[model samples]
Target: MDITPVANPALDPVQFPRLEEVEYLPVSTKYRGMRLALWGGVQLLVLAICLTPYLIYKFGGEESMATMSAWYWPVGIQAVFSLLWFLEEWKGFPRRGYAVRERDITYRTGWLFRSTTTVPFGMIQHSELSQGPVSRKLGLNHLKLFTAGGSGNLRIAGLEDDEAQALRAIIEARTRR
Candidate 1:
């Protein structure tokens, strides 16, 4: 048997499909509330921890004016940082979205430094659905797709319960084929 090497043909870039042109569906609006509840709880917990030391010092009958003044700076800095972080999440939520095509699924995220990940259905080994306490309370679910080989997995969060289940079913059907 003789194996002949075929001539390589150059492909035109213009013929390729444009990912930016694909219509992406935004995540559920309830995601904002879930994020606020989750982050707000976290911030409050951290603030409480930070204030514990100061509260102990003051209530322990050894209150120093210097210590009280010192506490303000650290707590103030933390408060400001948390506020900025929350704002980032709020502003960036709209930019987070996903698109499911007949052959693949794409997820785009980030506000400042954007990222887009696409996973073909043929490459998917399995998928899972998950929800955190806040997400469950908000009726939101996260769909995680695990691809074959060492390729990275993809997670599409902030989806409504029904939407996530439908998407999971679609993925399951596609993978079965």
Candidate 2:
């Protein structure tokens, strides 16, 4: 494999210097509470969906019992998955956070498949702040950074409005410099 350095006039240089250890900043604690409530509500919905067929079979007709019995395995699978999701969400909340350094910003997330992404200031094309309906209700905003790589990019959610703005400012300053 031949790898040579070639300069592109269109692209900026200094895509991040050597990485070193930096203190990570944690996201809002409120988000964990939100996760618990959201996943609990989801499990409740799953419970309803999983049980509906059995209830109908019990009340609707005796012949449909076989059909309902067949659904038991699928229901059991979803229940187990819901349980896993609940546990992962509970355990993963604290693991999520972002760290800003001199040359780049890094974000860490996920439970089962953990990922840590570092986006250099020069590679960052833009940053966006967004709030969905649920997030707005919960008083949280997301700071999404765009770079040359399109997917699996950096997005730090569960930030308070002021904190998100501050982080955005830091990123913008880095990009500008």
Candidate 3:
């Protein structure tokens, strides 16, 4: 998994350095599909809500249903957004993984459309270890690295606590020096 800059003169020396070998961190694959299921359930609930007014109009009351059906466009848009989110997550989260290289880190994600993003240690401003409720139950922690950019925070999730700590130290050491 090593990406070397030894033969590529065009690559920046500070960014690529002379990588030895890149190491992939351990990640949970068991719950990879859960996200999609959860999102789908939420979307279905919304769909039911959206159709409730129409159902009422057809049976319970005409004016009442028409008043509620005013939300048709908004609810329809929400359903479409939910569907897109589900599709994106279903195709992305399962394929997500990270690799630590000598001078930078790379994350590969997405299902139908894959993306590989590399973040050099030099650009990392700081980092943190975080765990959500589910992650805490699984004893998993994520390493979140912040860069100079306002929205470029990199998160490497589903790592062991010790691994997260070690990665934090490595990133700090590399960035501070």
Best by lDDT: 1
Q: Alpha-carbon error at 86 in model 2, in Å?
A: 1.3
Question: Per-residue lDDT of 1-177 in model 1, one digit per residue for the tens?
Answer: 999999999999999899999999999989877778778999999899889889999999989999888889878989999978886787888889999998999999877658899999999998999998878888999999998874769999999999999999999998896
**Per-residue C-alpha lDDT of model 3 across residues 1-177, encoded as one tens digit per residue:** 999776744766678443224554536664454455556787889888887877777667566645766868878798779877777776677567777777788877776677767888888888889887867776778788888884667887777777778778878888887
Q: Which candidate is the best by TM-score?
A: 1
Task: Name the 10 consecutive residues with the lowest summed lDDT in model 2.
Answer: 11-20
C-alpha lDDT of residue 120 in model 1:
91
lDDT of 2 by residue, 53-157 (tens): 788877887647578788789788998898788777777777888888778888887788677898888899899999988788888999999887676468888
TM-score of 3: 0.64
**RMSD in Å for model 2:** 6.3
TM-scores for every predicted model: 0.84, 0.81, 0.64
- RMSD to the native, candidate 3? 8.0
Where model 3 places Cα greater than 4 Å from the true spot, the runs are 1-26, 30-34, 61-87
